[model samples]
Target: MHNIKDLRKNLDYYKKKLLNRNYNLNIDEFVNLDKDNRNLISKKEKLEQEKKILSKSKNKANFEKSKKISEEISRLNKDQALNKKKLDFILHTLPNLALDDVPIGKDEKSNKLIKKFGKIRDFNFTPKSHVEISSNEIDFETSTKLSGSRFVVLKNKLALLERALINFMLDVHTIQYKYTEVSPPLIVNEDVMFGTGQLPKFEEDQFEIKFNNSDQRKFLIPTSEVVLTNLVRDSFTKKDDLPLRFVASTPCFRREAGSYGKDTKGMIRQHQFYKVELVSVVEPKNCLIELDRMLDCAKKILDILEIPYQIVLLSTGDMGFSAEKTYDIEVWIPSENKYREISSCSSCGTFQARRMGAKYKINNNNEFLGTLNGSGLAVGRLIVALLENNQNEDGSVTIPDALKKYMNNLDKI
Candidate 1:
């Protein structure tokens, strides 16, 4: 969310920025609504002052005048409240302004490649997809029968491999990177989702949970980022606790509402998957710096696994709703003959902080804290990368040296 005062003061500037993000600002509607709301407030204050003066005089005429003033104030209050609601709706719909340095573009085609790491393996035989490499253990047919498409049931070693990857990622982030690991609730209230900029906009993409005889709306978390980043919601932290880094490995649920026919095969896009999420809370001034560090932390996972990947700076329209700037770590998928996004590191600046009411106290002043979140790595996609990239002609998969210990010293699966 943006400061309403700032949006009012720099309406043109914000409109231009939002335009790059493909949002058309209805300036006239906002201006008129704001003007009317402020006018109503002014009228109400004037009536209250009159009623105060009338109350001092005990005459019947003064009493009637005060009664009329009270009714007028009541009416104005409702008008002001309604108008403010409309204004806030507009504010909530607006996406975060892109950082000035971010590339302006409509889509990923305009995204800039920042760097590439490791070498893409040269397969002597025509490489198959993860499905073909582990058709027996992947068990897509059974999973589809059990829970429909976009779901998988890994059997035996493949299941163990998935758990090992999650553990390996958590260890790297929590132990080496100093991120505090948390096991948060899988289901969260609506406000918690809104705190991370996932609600009131992307409602269709969420898997909402319905309850009998309950008014409270709940949802299965789309990512651990929702829970991890919201730890500072409606609270103030000390300056010494500036960067609160958290890591969590949890099952994520998404409806994939917008993606009707994309990545229908394998684990590329799933309704349920495990991810080791990384979130950090910091002072706004150091947000970009922290973003760079966070990006490195995520990239380190691929480095340890010796997986080939490339980093790209997402263009304005391609960035997430809450991110002012973003970097995507796309791992090479041998089957797809291309790189697919395995992690996305983003600096949300104070966008989420404002919505979350997350603040930090310094020098007796409270300022919104900056929030950043990224996939330390998506376990499912990493699994796909591993199975396809390390597959042998004999159909066995060679485990990376870093994960061998977690995989019970088994080099091949």
Candidate 2:
């Protein structure tokens, strides 16, 4: 959410910034509505003043006049509220402005590759996709029968591997990186979702829940990032705790609304999947710095898994709704003969904080906090990369050294 005062004063500046994001702001509509709302506020204040003056007299005429003024004030209050609601609706739909140094473009095609790590392994024979390699263990047929498409059932060692991956990520983040581990609720209220920029706009992509006895809006979290970042919602943190880092491994559910016919053959895209999410809350000035640290934390997981990956700075148009700048880590998929996104680390600046009402005190003044979130790594996609990259000609998969302990010293699956 943007400060209305700032938007009112710097309309032209915001117009250009939003345009780069491919969002066309209705400047004229906003200006007219703002003016009307302010006018109503002024009128209401004058009527209240008149009522106060009238209250000084006990005369019948004055009483009647005061009652009339009170009614007028009530009417103006409603009008102002309705006007503000319309204005806020517009503000809520606008995407965060991109950081100055972010590349300006309309989509991912213009994204910039920042770094490449590890060597892509050379296989003597043709490598098979995860679906083909784990045909016996990963049962999509059973999952489809139970829950339709975009779901999977990993049996035998593959099931153990998924659990191991989640545990491995949580340990690395909490023990080595100093993030506080949290097990947050999978279902959240509407306001909680809105606080994280997942409501009102991206409603279609969410799996909303309904109840026969309650009116409260609820949803299955698309990622633990929604719950982890919102831990600071409607609250203030002490300066001593400048950066609050949190990690969670959870089952994420998404509608995949506009993603039909994409990555349908494998676990690349799914309605249900596990993810180790990382969220950090810090001072606004240190947001970018925290982002760099967060990116490294996520990259560390892939490094430990010995996966070859590259980092890309997303274009302004490709960044998430709440992020000012974003970095995506794409891991090499041997079967696809390409790199696919396994993690996306983003610096939301104070955009989410403003929406969440999350703040920190600085010299007696409360200021919006900076928030960042990233996939420490998507468990399912990581599994795909691990299996495809480590597959043997005989069909067994070699486990990476880092996960060997977690797998009870079993080096192969």
Candidate 3:
């Protein structure tokens, strides 16, 4: 969320930016409302102070005057509501500021590629798409009959392949990267969603449920980022816990709203999938290093699996709502004949902390902490990439060396 102060102090600058994002909020009205709110608070404070003095006197006339002041306070409280509504309207329009180095682009077409890796697949005979080759192993028709489109049920070796990928990622993150492994809830409250910048926006892309209490409701977490990042929500930790690294492998749910017919074939797009997520809470000065570390952790997964991939820096308009910068890892998919996003690493800066109120008391000083999160790897996509990249001419997948142990030393599945 953006601060109303920015809108009030730099109306002209934000006005131009707002046009770029297609947001409509009258700047003058917002500023006036904010100014009114300040005045109302001032008036309320003054009235309370005067009433305090009058109450000290404890005379009958003073009592009547205090009562009148109380009535005036009630009226001002009513006026404050209108001011608050206007203030909220403006705050909701505040755009997530792009990082200084983020490339200025209109959309994905303008995103810049930082690097590439490995070679695209070649076939002696006509190579089948993943959906074609894995047909005997995957039950998509039954999945659709049971659930709906964009769902898959992995059976036989395909199921083991997905499980092997998840285990490999979690082991690497916990043992090699020294991150604390956690099992977080798949369901979270609205405040947790807001803390991660999911609420007040992107609501339709989520799945919500009514809770035991009629007034309470919860959302199925769209990503472990919401659950992991909010662990320190509203917290003030010591500097020794400066760089808190967390990793979790969990099932994530998404509505895929508005993407009804896109990537409708297989696991490339799905309503539910498993992923090993990486999150870090670190000192402000150490955030960039943490981002690199996160990328390294994710890259290790691709490197170990020997899957061809590229690292691309997302453009300003392409970055997420909360991210200051983002690096998307697009794995080579032979079937699609193009790269597909398998993981995204981002530095959200203090955007999430500011919303969640997750902060730290720096050594002998008061300061808020910073937060960062990324996908160690999205497991289903990893399976898709692995199957497509390592497919044998005989229609079996050659297990990557790193996953051989997890797969019981089997060379091919």
Candidate 4:
């Protein structure tokens, strides 16, 4: 949400920004409505002032006109509500400005790779895709029977390995990186989704359910990002607490609405998956720096896992709707012989805080804090990358040295 004052003060500037973001708001009408509301507020204030004056004076005629003035006030109050609704509708569609450093491009192909890490593992024997080799351990048929497509049942080694990966990432983030760990609710209200800029735009990508016997709706969180970022919802904190860091391991559910037939063969994409997510709330000045720190935290996970990966700065068109800038960590998959995104780190700036009513007392002055979120690692994809990158000659998967301790010292599966 943008500042209302911005709409009134420089409607022309905001109008252009809205158009740039492809918002379909009627700029003239929106400005006119706000002007009308401002006029009503002025009239209301004048009426109240007159009433106070009349009450003090012994002017009988002025007292007699008071009833008519009170009725006008009531009518104006009703009009105020309508105008407020119009203002809210316009503000809801307004988008955050793109970061100056964000590359201007149409799509994913234009994303700039900032750096690459690790070496692609070489395999002597025929390397099977994770989908084929893990077939015995993944009961996709049962998943289909129980639910539908884009779901899987990981059994035995795969299940254990996924759990180990989640724990491994969490330990690294909390024990090593100073991020406080949290286990937030998997279901959140609509406001929480909107706070993270997921609602009013990408509703189809989420699974929503109604609360029992209530009009309230709750959606299964598409990512821990939703829960972790919304933790500051409707909050005003001291500036000294400017940077609040949190991490959580959670099961994320997504509808994946547009991807009808893509990556259906394996765990490359799924309806539900475990992800260890990182979120930070900071002062405006620190947001970009924190974005780098958060990305490093994510890269550290892949580093420890010994996975070859590269960092790509997402092009404007490929960036998430809420994100001003995004950096994707793509791990090399030997089977595909290319890099695929394993995690995405993004700085939303103050875009989310404004929507969530999250602000801080900066220098003892009120200001909205900025928010950012990124996947420390998506457990399923990381597992897929590991299996594909570290496959042994005899069809076994070698565990990375860092995760071996968490896997009870088992080096391979």
The residue-by-residue lDDT of candidate 3 on 137-224, one tens digit each, is: 8789899899988789999888888888888899999999999999999999999998888887789999998778766669999999
For residues 248-364, write the lDDT of model 1, one tens digit per residue.
Answer: 999999999989889998889999999999999999999999999999999999998999999999999899999999999999999999999999999999999999999999899
Question: What are the lDDT figures for the candidates, one per model?
Answer: 0.94, 0.94, 0.84, 0.87
RMSD per model, one decimal: 1.4, 1.2, 1.9, 2.4
For candidate 1, what is the lDDT?
A: 0.94
What residue pairs are clashing in model 4?
none
- Model 2, range 167-237, lDDT digits (tens) per residue? 99999999999999999999999999999899889999999988456889889999999999999999999
User: What are the clash counts of all predictions, listed in order?
Assistant: 0, 0, 0, 0
Query: In candidate 4, which residue ranges exceed 4 Å CA deviation?
Result: 7-26, 51-64
User: If the candidates were sorted by their lDDT against the true structure, best first, what order would they fall in?
Assistant: 1, 2, 4, 3
User: For every model shown, what is its TM-score relative to the native structure?
Assistant: 0.97, 0.98, 0.95, 0.92
Model 2 lDDT, residue 171, Cα? 96
- Misplaced by over 4 Å in model 2 are 56-61
Q: For model 4, what is the error of residue 171's alpha carbon versus the real structure, in angstroms, after optimal superposition?
A: 0.6
Between candidates 2 and 4, the one scoring higher on lDDT is 2
* lDDT (Cα, tens digit) per residue for candidate 4, span 1-413: 77788667887776655454455567678878888988989999999888788778878988788878888888988998899887776677666766767776667877898999998777776778897777889889999999999999999989989999999999999999999999899999999999998887788999998768788889999999999999999989778776899999999999999999798888989999999999999998888999999999999998888889999999766888778789999999888888999899998888899999999986667788889999999998998898988887778888888888888899888
How many steric overlaps does candidate 4 have? 0
